[model samples]
Target chain A: MAIRKEKFTMIKVAAQNNIKADKIDEFIAIAKNLVAETRKYDAGCVRYELLQDVKNPQLLTMLEEWDDQEALNNHLLSQHFKDAMATFAGYLEKPGEINLYKTLA
Target chain B: MAIRKEKFTMIKVAAQNNIKADKIDEFIAIAKNLVAETRKYDAGCVRYELLQDVKNPQLLTMLEEWDDQEALNNHLLSQHFKDAMATFAGYLEKPGEINLYKTLA
Candidate 1:
């Protein structure tokens, strides 16, 4: 059967104290490229997009959808994801908030 | 004092278990218009925009910015806000999740 719907994942990161603007740029750039790779490689994943806070632009939100939870879990553990986390660790101002869920309706 | 920056508020709604597609459209339409009004009338609010889930398209997220917390509270209690809530009550599948924040760096 065809997939009915995908879940939306909301991820947020708060800037750490005294971080520089230039570093924020570097982090975001790396994130964009890395996330693109995950989307391309994960066939079960439906779509991924990033949104920036309108006023507090430093806050980044990612929207993702997958065929099902299993597909999502697998994608999370993929090599590209692990490598990206290792590389991007230093740029974060703080640990990120991540919430994943399937569509309710 | 000149306004420095605004806080970002993120809001989400889950679809009611048996909600239909057309009602989602109605709820979103009303929301989009009502939100536009709030942005135009509330000077302390810097910006507001809505984004939909990339995979689960029915889910929506609203991004808002305000001059400060007080401004945000005032906006929440505004006449338009109450009216919108009253008008849109029937469309909700569940209570919306609302999170407010300020920029760190």
Candidate 2:
């Protein structure tokens, strides 16, 4: 790779959700609904996706893009998020990990 | 999240790069060049992003989308990938992790 100059501007949310073995299907069902709702209702969300690990299907991850920090904050505080969290109760193997990022390029 | 039905079809690649603390800047510089080149040359690449962790700047993740498995496979086999990997030598703190996924919704 040749060293070149360019700038990338984007805010991303990377999160992991580990579901119980038996509840994998159920978790996916609920998550699909959540993704659709988020895409429809949140204009700030450029993209929201749920992905399943190829090696371990039970391990899932969400990759999201927002216009900015404020937009992401608003979405997290929205009723949809609250309600989504409610439905997720007892479904996760643990709290899981979520992180934010800004593109370098 | 209300339970609703929706289908999402996309191929995503999630990868991590843990750069040596001293080489982080160099890594980003090389990465930015690679990203621009990939975006310019690849038609099947819908989106290719590089992100830095908010809490730990040394931890970086790449999120990429391709039209299908064939497109992604082509990218993996491309000269650009080979060149990029070459530039990455000795810069990593660890081997890093890369995984493929199919969106659930």
Runs of candidate 2 with Cα error greater than 4 angstroms are A1-10, B1-9
Listed per candidate, the RMSD to the true structure in angstroms reads 10.2, 7.6
Error of 2 at B1 (Å): 40
Model 2 chain A weakest lDDT span, ten residues long: A5-14
- Could you give me the TM-score of model 1 versus the true structure? 0.47
Number of backbone collisions per candidate: 2, 2
lDDT of 2 by residue, B40-89 (tens): 98768998988899889989878798887778878878898778888787
**What's the i-RMS of each model?**
8.5, 1.1
lDDT of 2 at A103: 78
* Clashes by residue pair, model 1: A16-A93, B16-B93
DockQ values per model: 0.08, 0.64
Name the lDDT of candidate 1: 0.58
Q: Compose the digit string of candidate 2's lDDT tens values, residues A1-105.
A: 899865445689878888899999888888888899899998689989889987888788888989888788888888888887887778888788787998777
Q: Where is model 1 more than 4 Å wrong at Cα?
A: A1-84, A87-105, B1-20
lDDT of 2 at B17: 89
